[model samples]
Target: MTSILIADPIPLLNKGEQALLEGIVESLNIIFSKPDIMLLSNYPEKDARRSRIPVINRNPVLFKSIKKIMPRSAFLLEGALMAILARFGKQNFRRLFTRSELWQAFLNSDIIVVGHDSSVSYDAVIIGWLLNKPLVIFAGSIELFRNKLKESIAKVLLKKVNLITLREDDSYKALMDLGVIPGVKTQVTADAAFLLKPCSPERVKEITQQEDLPVHDRPKVGVTLTRQMCERSHQEINDVNERYKKAIAEKAIVLDEIIERYNVEIVFFPHCIGPGKNDDRLVARDVIQLMKRKDMVKPVVSDLGASELKGLIGQQCEVFIGERTHSVIAAMSQGIPSICITFPSDRRTHGIIGGMICQRDFIYNVERLNPIELLTLVDKLWAERPVIRKKLEGIIPLVKERALNSARLIQTIVSEKEKSDNGYRCPSSQH
Candidate 1:
């Protein structure tokens, strides 16, 4: 059996990352008969249960542990310290690649698929080198580096991957601008989550029953906002504490207006349920508190798996407005109209993805995040839901095909490696 290990899946906390892992695994299962798969995550039990794969819990490296101990305000300082340490030599870098669980899983696997949804930090590339294995940067996006020192480190590590497939044109350009090495098999593909099929109807019924979610007669609007993005905006903008306050407060007002005009029920989907600031449930509730019609807004904070959450969104929501890329993806894949709200420095993932289905009608930057403008956009999108759904119906399948191609590319790469090891074709070829 071919053993494949997925690194940095982070399935439990963030639903978008979960969708990517599941989409890839689903493709793998179709091509390979019962391949051995292992996932690495911080929340092993939750991830394993959700993905239906054995998982190894990855421990934080010394630097990461130290960084975590510091207050969030010092994140920039921690990043600088890490960059300085990384520039010192490979010894500092190798210290991060020596986790026991990560090493054990890498040794047991034939191929490594690194998630690109997060930043390209080069940890997986280093681990791949230690095991002398080929690795792929799965369907994800990367930012164009503004810092030269970090860019140097990123370029060196990114080039080591066996294959690099990015989700959008902007990310592809970012990789090129960062200087990808020649002869590295690189291509542009849609995000793996774009291929995500909803959960079974039976499972959907089970979830709705267990959660006791109301079956609203009016249109249901699904919403998700990430606390991380809001906090990051706080750091980036000037006198923005008031602006951030207004953004959330204004969001509530917009929703109220939307409810009044369209008679829609708002359902808040908290994709990240991790500890501390990562808990989106808190943000969802806070937004509800700011709303005028609190009775019309409901928060779904249950520990639902990614597909189940997507299934719920697909089944109940007439339209979605989410800061989380995956929540919007879940909505769009099911032909639900969506509006993706992105902040500054967002690698253009939201704009590119939303444009594929709804043109620019559904993509909004958070810079102009105000009640009046948002209400206008929401009204326009709700009015255009039929046309938007029609566009999504045509686009989603093509995106899925592109996502599955990543898996096929992996098979071809592994097959060629085995062929070169022996004079004849590999024995596994017939399967």
Candidate 2:
């Protein structure tokens, strides 16, 4: 059996990452002939073929404790906002985030697959380069888009790697222009997480049972928000807030109206529950409070497990407006159409829009947002979805195909790594 390793820095995953990782591990397990897969994550689970190998960390109990603290996570997320503020103020608050064991785990892996934007992969990429491991990456806005410096590092990292599994043709071509060679050796694969299986209707009914109300009776709506644009200078913030404030205001306005107009019950879901200003829980809290009535709306605040969240998304919710990339992905996989909101530079917008393949228009760009226009588009989409959904059924297979291609890449990587270990010639460095 070919052995492979998964390096995820954020040990305690928020819903989307967990679902993505699960699909990757399970698909590879089968395709690679039930390979012995070792995963080094902060939160490990016990499963059959895959072993959640624990890394050396002092006080696992404390780490677990820190993970469950929702408010604290929001506050810590604020530190990222602070850290960004510090970039301007020159404060350097990032030294607190380094985990020595994360890299140590990377050193032990045959291939290291990392999502973008985590401080863990920030170092993991370098470690892979230093160790000469086949470094495979699937990055875009969901992991936060790269800035100039990150782009620079990503360039070097992409070059140093044995293979580059890009998420989109745009990103793939960008790399190719910067000297990435494409062939069977270096392929453009889908976001491996897109292979996620939707929750069955029965499974969906089971998870929401704890919520009590009959599936049809509950007015279920999914809401997600990210405050990255808000952490900027007041002028920049105001510009974005003005553009999006109306959209947020409109979403609130429309949602408030939807609650009244449709007698719908809205459920706010915090996609990224990390520290301070970036804390989605706080943003959800802010939005919930901003809306008039607490009785008509609810926030599922438990930091749910992946399966639980996926089932929730699949449940016959009237609508799910995705504020995060994975939220849209989860919704689409479940045959639920979503209105995706993104910042100007969000790579995820392109990723999901591409996934939609013009089958169903489910994207809303937040930078140049016009709430009234967006609301108009939402109206048309809402009215047209029955027809739109049929279109989705046709394209779902294409999206699913891309996801399987990602698994193909992982299997190929594992095979190539095995060949290297057996002292075969290195897979001709086509990339």
Candidate 3:
């Protein structure tokens, strides 16, 4: 059996990340016959419970435990010492520290796939490179690094990857700017989340009824928000918090106008619930508290999975105003018109919504958020919703095809590797 190790520390709380993981897994299942898959996780026990696939900690258990009590300098020293031991220690010495399991998993896997955009995935890429494992970065959105050191490191790491499938044209262009050319090694694809299947209509209805979301009584307008809108700004800590409060207040005003003018129920989808201040639920609560019409607004606080949440958005919403990329993608995939609220430097929005979906005009930068402008755009979307929906229907299939193309490319890489290793060709190649 072919073994594949996914080096993403899957955060189950964030629905967007969960959607990416599920879509990638679903796509892989179509290409490989029950491939033995393992995941490296920060919350290994929780992730193991959530997913059927085996999960392992990114670091050894003892080191992780020791990290809590050790001082920062000591911890760094210990980490360096452990690395040397793992690399050069005698077999029994390494076995004594339980370093074998982590190293063995990396050594045994045929390929390592990175599905996240964070530093955790970059660390995995470095390790996989050192081990000489086939590496594929799937559906990533790469942006130009503002830091020279980071840019240099990214250039080095990305240049060596077997395949790098980007989710947006901006990312592909960014790679080009960094001298990573578009060839056999690099290609543009759509986000993996586009292939994630939503829950059934029956399930969506059940969720609506369970959450008391008045989806049946009125036209529902789905909205998503995140704290990053303020945090990502080039401001000091104090300024960021103050700006966040102002942004939330402005959003409340916008939602109030949207509700009164359009006679629609505002459903707040907290796409990322939290590990910290990044929680959308807290932001939604603040927005709700500041709004005049609390009865017209409902925040989804239930623990719905990514697909289930996508089902609710796609099935119940007439129009979506989303800050989360995946939430907007969900609405778009189902032919629902959406306005994307994005951070100033978020290339994913510019690339996907602007370039692929052809809805560049609907994207609003949160840093320069104007209620009047947003309301005008919302009015336009409401007026032309039928046309917008029709346009999306025609466009979504092609985007989905592009999304699935990443999976086909993965299959090709795996098949070619297998053929070279075993001197046997794949059945698909026979045709």
Candidate 4:
């Protein structure tokens, strides 16, 4: 069997990350002949319970404690030392330095795959490179590093990667700016979530009833919120809390106006539940609590899986106004018209929504957020939804094919590795 390791630690609480992992796993299963797969997850026990595949904690307790104390430079230096020890030390020392099970999985794996959605991490890349493992980064939207140390590190580590399939043009451009050579090693692909299959209609209905979403005759407008959406950059604000509350209040007023003007039910999709204050559920609650038309608003408070959430949105929503990138992607994939609420730092919205899907008009900047402007955009989106939906129907299939192509590219990398290593044999074939 070809043992494959996904290096990123997926947290099920973040449905976008879950969607990426699910799509990648589904694609890999279809591409490979029952390949042995394992996940490195943040919530390993929970993920293991949900998935048939073996799950290991990406950050073990000891490592987590160590990272908390160590400065980033010191931490990275320690990782380098450990990698070197793992590469050249005695068996016992290697086991000690590599941190047991995590490194053991790294050593046993034929290929190391990193799924980068909104952000990029270089931990897996560094270790995988040191171990001489074939590494592929798929469906990534890599941002240009503002910090020089991170930029330098990215340049050094990324060059060693076997393949890098970016999800957006901005990421590709960022890679070029970082001086990573493109073409075969780097290619732009659509997000893996684009290929994620929604749950059955029956399951969707079950989730709808379970969440106690309104079953009224009015058209439903799906909305996704995040704490970040109500935040401005620290440079722009003195009192963050005050500004956030003000933003929430402003949003509440706008949503109330939207309800009254359009006679639409606003369904808040909690795209990310929590790890902290970043929870969409909390943000939605804050907005809903301040709104006058509470009866017209419903928040999906249940911690549902990515496919289930996608199904609910696809079946129920006529228009989506989403702060979460994947929520917008999910809605757009289903041929539903969506307005993307984007932060200044978010490259994904412009690159994916504007560049790929050609819906630049519907993307609104959160920094310069105006309630009247947002309401106007919503009105325009509502009016032009049919045409937008039609455009998406024409474009989404091609984008989905690109998403599937990422998996095919992985197969090619694996095939090339097999060809180059004559002494290596599949464990299943050996048996």
Candidate 5:
């Protein structure tokens, strides 16, 4: 069995992250027949094992100690401190690298697959180098974090990765700006979740039945809203509460108008569910409370797997409007009309993905948002649903094909390594 270690993914919290993990596992299974795959997770062993997948708890001793003494409300501060340790300092960095469990996991893996959501950590890259193992970074955005020290360390460490696959144009440009690593093979591909198969007809039927979702004779819209648009844990905004109130009020108004004008029923889909402050379930309820016509909206809080939820959206909704990128991705993958409400700071990932799949006009920047403009676009989209669906039907398949290219690349790299180690040469042309 080819052992692969997946790093830097919290598979149990956000559904988008869950989908990315599932999609990569599916691809690896297809490529290696029987690969032994493990994940580095911040979640506890018992909780992480609930997925029935092998997981290594990645919280180092320092992190555990921090959590033990720190109050729950200071979680974000704890994260900032951890980030500093990971990037700024030498002592904590050595402590992380010297951890026996981390080194053991790194040494055991035949190949390391850094996840599809963010860049790999410097420690992970260093471990890969120390072991001389080939690493493939799967699809995701890649930009330097706010820490310049981290950026410098990452630039040096990333050079050792065998292949780095980027999922969107913005990340490609960001990588170019970061300067090319001499030996790393870089490729652009669609997000792996694009190829995620939908839930079975039976599963869809079960979900709708359980939720008592209206299937026909009425227009239905799926909406995903998160606290990400309104607040950040560490950042200070002028009158943050007032900003949230304004945004929430605007969203509620939009929802009400859409229902009033189009006679559409709205279902709020919670994309990220957990105990965290940014839990989508909490934000969904907050939005509902702020709405004038709360009766028109219902929050679906099921614990369905990622693909299953995507299937529900495909089967049940006429259109999807999401603040979360993956919810929009799910809708687009299934040929449903989708709109992404983006934050102004997100100049890359959101716009690039939506522009590539849907038209550029479908991407909305929240900072410059106009309620009337959005309502007009919604009405237009509804009017032209057939044409949009047809376009999506043509686009999604090609994107899926591109997604599979990442899997093919990993297979080729692994196969060549096995042959060379066994004293057999791969044909010169194959190189």
Candidate 6:
């Protein structure tokens, strides 16, 4: 069994994260005939198990204790290794506990497929390089979290990496600024989110009814809370509310206006939920209070799983207004036009634009947003919905195309390791 190890965000996390996880997992299982080990982190064995394919769920203890540790990646890897060791009878030593032990895990594997929507650990990248294995990063604006120092580290990691496959042109440029070299091997692919198909009418109807969503022929709008901020713990709710007050207030007004002008119906989608947090409810409550129309609908309050949530979004909206990139992704996948009201630090708007997407896809700096400008864009997007949908149809096919190409990059890197393990080529070293 040419074992390939997958490092991805698991579905139990949130809808956007789940969508990425589901898409990546299904792709690997279908594309690779070989039996593999998927090192599942942050989720339990039962939670990570699949239906048909056999996969080993390596339990880790350290990850459970990974709470705001300094040098986050080191802590993440340490936590994972400790957790894995605890599953056995062994105690984790501080030092094969060395990088060498981690290298062996990578070298023994035929390939390593990193996240399409996952947070790639520094350990994963470093060890993959040490093993001289093929390293491929599948994602959108994967650099969103990295700063200058981290970007330097990423450049070094890219040295032995086979490819850094980004779904957005702007992200590719972001990588270049960080030192990713330009070449045929450095791929700019479309987001895998587009590969998710629309739900069957029965399935859609089921979820729509289950969520208490409106299903009439009236024009509807989708509203997905920010996936990252949405899934934080209950303790974080007050913090988000205080921090993002202006943006939320601005958005509430936009929704109210759209409801008045277009008679908008909404599927109030929540992307993530931690132990006791309900961000969507908070958002939904705020929006409801702000609205002038009771006819503007909202989905019922309950934790909808990732698949069901996507189905609900797919069926309910003609367009979406979201804070999360993946929420916009859900809207995009369905050929439903969306506008991302982004945070100050987010570069996703630029990335989507690089793919030839227009400004209608996203707007940046919502924290200091001009209400008039935002409302104007909303009205304009509403007016040109059909034209935008037509363009998205052409864009949708690129999702799978990019994924397949990304898979090929990993295949080439893994194949080369069989010939020599002296050193691997850096992505920067390519043409």
- Compose the digit string of candidate 3's lDDT tens values, residues 263-298: 999998988877888788898999999999999999
RMSD of 5: 7.1
Q: Residue-pair clashes per candidate, as listed?
A: 0, 13, 0, 1, 0, 8
Worst 10 residues of 2 by lDDT: 422-431
Scored by lDDT, model 1 comes in at 0.72
Candidate 5 Cα misplacement greater than 4 A, ranges: 45-52, 60-104, 145-147, 232-237, 422-431
Ranking by TM-score: 4, 3, 5, 1, 6, 2
Angstrom error of the Cα, residue 138, model 1: value is: 0.6
lDDT of 2 at 377: 64
What TM-scores do the predictions have? 0.84, 0.73, 0.87, 0.90, 0.84, 0.75
Q: What's model 5's overall lDDT?
A: 0.72
| Candidate 6 lDDT, 64-93, residue by residue in tens | 444345444553465345334323324334
Q: Pick the candidate with the highest lDDT.
A: 4
TM-score of decoy 2: 0.73
Put down candidate 2 lDDT per residue, 1-431, tens digits, no spaces. Answer: 44355654434445566566666665665566756555554434422112233333221232344546653353233323332332333323322222233333433456666543222244445544444567665432223334877666655655665555555566555655555454324655565556656556676666556654344575576767767533321344556556445444545666676676557687776666654455677766766666776677767666555556666766746667766777777766666667877665555456556543563356765655554666676676677767766766777677767666656776677777666652111122111
Highest TM-score against the true fold, candidate: 4
Q: Could you give candidate 5's per-residue lDDT for residues 39-108 as a string of tens digits?
A: 8876756347435468876655435565577644233343334334433457545355334454445545
Error of 5 at 330 (Å): 0.7
What is the C-alpha local distance difference test score of candidate 2?
0.55
For candidate 5, give the lDDT of residue 3: 76
lDDT of 3 at 418: 71
Ranked candidates (lDDT, high to low): 4, 3, 5, 1, 6, 2
Candidate 1 lDDT by residue in tens digits, 106-197: 54566778656755536665655544567888776777667989889888878778888777777777777777845578887677777667
